[model samples]
Target: MVPQRKLLKVFKKTTYLTTFLLLCIAWSRLRLFFLNVKSQPNAVEYNGGLIDDIKLMKCYRWYKNCETLYAQSAVHDNSFVLWNRVSKNMTDSSLYAIESNWLYETFFYVHLFNTNANKEDEKQPLADIAVSRDPSLVPLTVLQEVMPSLRSSDSMMGNKRLYYQKTSWWYRFWNNPLPTKMNLMNKWKHNNDILWSKIQHDSCLITNIQLYLGSNFVESRPFWKEIIHELHNEDGNSIPISITRKVECGFDANHTFPKNTINNKDLLQLKQKSDLKILQLSDIHIKGNEENSAILGEFQSRIFISRIIDIERPDLVVITGDILDGNKSVDYQTCILNVVQPIIRAQIPFVISFGAKDFSKYATQQEITDFVNQIPYCLNKNSDSNGHLTIPYNFSTIPNDSKDDYSNLITQNDLAIFIFNSKTSKRQFFKDYISLYKSPPKLALAFQYLPIPTYRLSGVFPIIGQYNERNLLPEGFDNDDNLINYMHEMNIKALSCGFDHSNDCCLQSIHDIWLCYSGATGLTAPHSIFMPPSVRLFKVDNIDKSITSWKRNYNKIDEVYDYQYIYNQPKQKHTPSN
Candidate 1:
């Protein structure tokens, strides 16, 4: 009778307790969200510190992490925190999580905002805006500044708590463990860490951050504010003093050689000691898509070589790969041997390697053996021809045409070019026509046919044979080994091969095994369909055993393969005749 008199009051008390628990959960979530936001701000930065599309993607991912964390804490546990003004009122953890998720979606729009900001930065007359408006760059950089708001409190929610939770006994029936804020926080942390690293390295980010904050993001913004105010006061004019122009002043150092250019004294001194000039051409897929004008452009291989020979007058030419998109038996002889080999003939001590496209997918061990036997001219006039193996032009006159004496064809260096032959995924289709005849009709994967892998795989494996990561070269091939003992090898200081086109080239090791790639002739063949075509000139002073790269890029389309090397420099400056 006494309980019945106050049933409503008892029910209200129980409900209040439940609501209080939920308030605690929401608060916990808020703490977790703050920690995540605080830890990941650097990840959203690009260039090594922050500023790029990848960074934006990373920010969006972090925001998504915040949503997932909320959903997990609410759905997984009956016990959770709440958003309370003065610790009296309570809110449901589930509803709070849902609201937090709404914030997540709202932040996703922030991503779009950042992307648009970047796009607008690209489209707008940044220079004019920077000069005309005192705070033109600040509005665009607002997003970077705004990110810190998410990290207001870190301790109550503690940064580490953003990542996980133990499953309640009631929730243990399901296969998956209870979701925690840490899932997204951990991922965001990883991504942001990468973004931070990248942004730290980026010059644009550095300069911009310097412009905005002066030294740090927060400090730089205030510094820029003062700078803008000062810049506007210079002449009492609306237009501010322009630092934007200064930013772009030294953007391209390569083309803008100084009138009183001081060459690197050591490099210049080395050049004086020995004339080591090299011609490097890479990623030249000859038989790619017909519309892919890169190959057609490179068809002017003869013209470029002629120009380079005239200009550089170098001793050697090194070709990396895609010698002619030879994925099949038909393409090797027709495109590569016919198109590129003629141009290579102009240089002495020409070294080359096999790109992936040169191998046969259907080739058995015997077929591979035969393929290697015809190594000198893997795909030449003699390939699928009347009984005669193809010979290099310089040594075509040598009688008794056998594989052993094939190296005798070249006049210089007393060294034989060991062309690597590696197969690709499309090799099966190339080796046999049946795969193409199937119902699905195996067409080439548009991206895979570029032969870039074949070029690199073929080029590198031989250099670093079946060796462990640290120990390069296969058994018996290492220095002071059985092969060295048997062959009495002398003066083989460098092993150079090319393919894997990149103008920003590198040497994997010292001269013992030099990994060199002669940038592509057709910039449009693979992923570089948008970039300008480029090439590298490698010069090696045989006496000094020194090598150097003269990287060059061409804006004009026709000028791509229209020049040659002379002493490791372009023979003629390709003036647009049109």
Candidate 2:
């Protein structure tokens, strides 16, 4: 009887526990179902059309005023306004009112046009509702469906706000004296009324609002731009700030590429002339505006280059690499612009021989090539792949008063100019091209970034300019003499390079081939203070059948120096001992 009672009790207890478990499960399922239904957006009915209603609602004012307020605050404070809402519980209501303008402007249209309203006849919420309520609680998915740009704006604005917050003084001045509540409210209301009036007057579709807001959000609330943001103090030095404007957006359409460009016809005309002057600029290590001081800004490099271009007025310009300090430059595009703008403005045809330091983790060689291609008057052929360019100017006949010594070598009075990327290992392309020619042209000049092995034998050979740094060859060519031997055999008259910043020497190697450096042409690069920035100039006189080279320094007093003949003057019979 006792065992039977115990078994009955156990069964009853088990039944009770099962019933409670089932009830809990059912309750949870019901709760989940209700939550899902709540999250789902309700169907909206448009009286005219969804687009027309949005246009009538003047929702675009929200976007325009939001962006306008953001820009104004950024300009006024010299920093990005914080996107997150300030705590209302704080003691300073005036401060809160002033600082919360961005948030109010950002969501004012959404609140006024509240598509989330349950019924078509339901009155829309006031614009200030978004400010009163916690912004995070708002349904982002619903907002996104109405205006896709809002999501992107929210994301970009928040990120920029946080980034600047960490570095800006505007965010740190919480304890500063605040305006009286009456004055703050009056100013706020006035600003709000102005924005409201503007919104009521403007009519735009939802798509237009999205487009305007999306495009201008990043532009208005930028964390970095071509112009560096800094605060001026009593000492005249500025305290650097983190906020900046959009560089691409700041680019003026009026800054078009120069119209002057060199073509086959132009080259032919130049060939007809007695001489062709070529300017070689190298090691222009532009590290962006921020990395440099006010005096040494990237703009200063452009100014210096512009001044030199005006003085030299060379027919052709060759930039021998290290055009950008990729690792240090905050903006590679701006850095590149600074370096090329001067040349582009001057409208001289130019080519680039990329150096090892021209690209870094931030900027790749392909990116640099693509950017350079956008500018006019640039003659870089295959700049992205191997940076190989071959320009052959074939004349109808040799000059009327030509020397007999050039009869064999100068078959057609053709002049050939080859630009190679020393950073590349593939020489087969040039080798094949050179093989096609039985003999070299009357004058052949090659431009590259790194000097050939012959340059290392500077002491052994007769050099014209200063030799300060040790010679360096590109990788994969350690103790390699193949390239040097090929150039010598091909009768390539001059090989100009620019990796060694301090070594601007033109060494007369065996077979009378000249290896020259363009020197460091930028202020930011590590160079001797004694040796100012300079460009190497090559004057190829077709009439003289000679190449004369010299250096033009930045100094106003003694600009030109190291004047020497590169080819067809006198042969130095010196050889490197094995």
Candidate 3:
């Protein structure tokens, strides 16, 4: 009886141990499965042509067989209509089989031969295959009409046609493609006319091909490569199909600067001069769309900016904020490219201080920073820099006088240009800037999107220029005095902001710092008054130890207003405008 009882106790202990181990294993496996699902990318990596080639061959064979059948049929009806009728009668046996007229048309476009279709010696087809996964249909007939002109101008390949496919949930879950690439490819087709105008001067072609199951952003992928084509599934979703050719091009494929590097001839010229001219273009709310009005407005804005750059010929350009109407823009990337084209063409060193609208459903702040930094002559600092810029200057001629030393003070570089993002942690960024250098440059100027509390106060403080609207402070900065104190402590002479479109004023704060506003430069943004679009210009003279600023209205007469000296000024009673 004692042996039997002991045996029962041992069995019970073994069963309990086994149960506990099994529970732990099950929990761990479940956790791992969830983690894997969470970590999986929206799109799969590009598989170089193994499966893609086989699929392409199958599609080609189906297309040839269909063409033969259509030619044999004596029906004189529209090819598109007849193809539909025939497809309805045919049995769907394979994945590549043309089961609908849309598929037949897609296949026809994809296999479209050049003018030398009958020439047997011409082995390689003139047109390459483009597959789109987007639900929106490409205007194949319109594109066909435009293709010859594009080919004649060398803007596109001879007669490329896009194929379509329907996407499946299982395929998307396992093999989705990068969204950025897909978006770009879709943009190329949808905004072909706009894209052609933008890239007509550059030679572009497809150098590499990739196949993806679904579309999603390349969060972990680097931005060095550019998308040349997109693959589409039957449901109208799209994936990145090809990479930009490795030739000299004007767009994203080729960038002059590496990450966080600043190389601009105009910036380098600052070392040799005592005076620097800076152009502040604010609120050029460009909405990249297909509308004629939108296109014309964007074009006019570019011309206006170009004319201003040519007229002012400033040493640097500072776009205050709201470069694009992010909410309204069809393509944020295209809008960004359009916004910066003038500055890039002028070869002027520029920095951007993004606004509230800059961060929208279309793009994040980091993505904008990354995209802008890639453009040539752009001095936009990396995310880590907290939007700080110091123009490099020669230190050999440091002024000996303590008073002049402040003016001539050069830390890592010569003049300090601090650009703050209103949406970011302003106080923290200020703290970080202060911590970086023991003392600030005497004539340092700051740029941001939203105005501080000091700008809104009336009475006692001397104000210049037009204050047509109320001031809007950045979030959590209404009662915060640390930023103003930091600017004062750093001896930052002036701070320029651009959120209030109607308020274009320079007010002397109690801290002796100049708080200025750059009026709206965009034609599309709202305006309380019947004033023309305008940009503020700042000229900093090291020899005179002064900074002069004024607004130039975009009109036939080039009207100028609110001219004021920022430094060494006397207190005045009333606001002035010209």
Candidate 4:
């Protein structure tokens, strides 16, 4: 019989082919690993193209506060693309994505590398160190941006792959398909494509290519390298430069200024002519776990908030607190950064009020306040233990016919948004009176702190609908009989607070004064898939001195009973103190 070695050598081609294929697989995986590990150096650029889009967004934005309607470019600006950069760079959203993706891909890569490339497992989370990004302001940016597929539907399951078993029946039956589910999805995708036709009207927005394989466990890395290169370049336009619109909310532009207006043009101009869309995301109780492994809650919240910002493009965002779910000391920085960074990047002024769970986990109330003040766009600038946040809209005060900056004196609509630290989340005071009478239950959750009367909720929801039962404000603020009295004096029309994840809104006073209990923006973990999360929105009819609010429970919009709260100048609800 022929020697065993000689028998193996007889099939040299097969052996060489098998070896070649194994190397290819390892190489392909290595490339994928590198892709996710590195911050695409060119991601999230704020280039002139984007600045121009910002101009278009200003012009084509649903709320046309300015008279530049016709001037709204023959082309509509893409707000989605501009906002994408703001989200990716402003927060760790993209970085976390890259790191996570890299770790996943590297797992496979290193395994293959160990077997094929003669490398050993160092037990490293990733193969390489993370790259840094520029956070400073600059013009003409070139970025590698990450975005939810502009092509995706409003479906919560998220983006679908291109080639799937579910092909359109119209194509299968050889007929032109329009108005089909596939067709509608396609058109919705075209929405983003439509934005770029104006910007790059000269070139093809996308190109398609077919791929091939070499072995069952191996693939050609060269083809992948070319694809990745194209992907990196293709992303340049298909990403930060793309646009998508998926809003179910209504937009009202027909304006009838209040019947009696101040004669001052500057002041009248300050009255917002356009409908104000204020997006409220409350009770996103992100746990303060410092570990990178348990950040899905934070990620989900960031992604949802950012996506909603893109879709809603609201004039203001109100984040009713309870943003952190972990102990106040547990990686509060990460929770705070992930929570508020998007608003900061969008340059939208926002307000935050504390909730029962906000300080329940780890950080103290003061620590949370310090974190909030660090964000520039956070208008809650009170350093005391008092209970109020006053945020000014950074509106452009450019006069109708003059070009002068009145930055200091005026804000959008010359209106103010007030946030109250309604004492829903207690300051670790009175303990719960459970089965034990002053037994000091071993696992005590809430109890009133001596002299403060701040009721805390350790592991239970705060009892709502009980007025004045708990401390509604810090002790310092009790000097005022009722906070509404102060709101009346300040001409504050919108006051928002959160503690209850319930969607509760009411016209608590006359003349369009709104007292809103913004429902939880994100649900507590280990919840059922069907437990709908709630968020609040206010569409302000500035001329009417009134606002209409809607409660968004999951994807459904539930209008409150007294949703429309409009002010009539003649009918004063309550008298202000002298």
Q: What lDDT does the true structure give each of the candidates?
A: 0.31, 0.51, 0.53, 0.37
Candidate 1 C-alpha lDDT tens digits along 1-578: 88876997888998999999878856645664565554333233111111221111111235423321222223444442211111101122221111123223211101111223443342111111111122112221222233445433221232333323445554444322222222221112111111111211112221222111011011111112222221322233222111211122222212121121212111111112234455556655554222435434654543454555666665545455555454422223223333344443442444344444444332333433343332232222122211111112121233342333423333332122222222223223222322222222111101111222112332444332111112122221112222211111322222333333433233333223333344466433342444344556654443433444455555542333322221122245688886
Model 2: per-residue Cα lDDT over 300-390, one tens digit each? 5667788878888888888988886766544454455557766766666778787767764544556667767644566764343566776
Q: Ranking under TM-score, best-scoring first?
A: 3, 2, 4, 1
Choose the strongest candidate by TM-score. 3
Better of 2 and 4 by lDDT: 2
Global Cα lDDT for candidate 2: 0.51
Model 1 Cα RMSD, 1 decimal = 24.3
- Using lDDT as the measure, which candidate wins? 3
Indicate the residue-level lDDT of 429 in model 4. 18
Better of 2 and 3 by lDDT: 3
Ranking by lDDT: 3, 2, 4, 1
Over 11-68, each residue of candidate 4 has an lDDT whose tens digit, in order, gives: 8878999989877745633553343344443443221111112111111122211111
2 versus 4: better TM-score goes to: 2
